[model samples]
Target: MSKVENSSAESGQVKVPESVVMTVKNFRSASDIDNFYRYINDNRLRREAKMILDTVVKAITPPKRRRRSKRVVH
Candidate 1:
């Protein structure tokens, strides 16, 4: 766990624990032009929480039961 520092103007206060800045930096540096798409695709959930809802919909959906086929007499 790393700590980042940022300062506020109006309040004149200093804050820390802005690790997301580091995460983005790491993400950019590690990813190449072609692989960047994969990186974004992989991190889409982290970028936007709404993706979890979409995944939940798929997870909660009930699977359709298949009807048994009757065997014909030979």
Candidate 2:
């Protein structure tokens, strides 16, 4: 039996949906154990925000200069 299967049986609740239970387990593993009980948590938006901030940082930083140069002289 799977983790969700065992949990559902112990809690006296109807068999939990596989996808929902997997999502719950993954979310719990990603966060600290102390707050893992917060079932409403979703990190997708938080990770997206971090990605946006990183992109903005890269945009604002100066680009590296190339050694190539073109000049004409007689």
Among these predictions, the greatest TM-score belongs to 2
Specify the poorest-scoring 10-residue window by lDDT in model 1. 1-10
CA deviation > 4 Å runs, candidate 2: 1-44, 69-74
User: In model 2, how large is the Cα lDDT of residue 46?
Assistant: 58
Best by lDDT: 2
Write one digit per residue (lDDT tens) for candidate 1, span 1-74.
23333325445675656653456547656546338656657877445545766788889999889999999999
TM-score for each model: 0.28, 0.29
Off by over 4 Å in 1: 1-50
Report how far residue 64 has shifted in candidate 1, in Å.
1.0
How many residue pairs clash per model? 0, 0
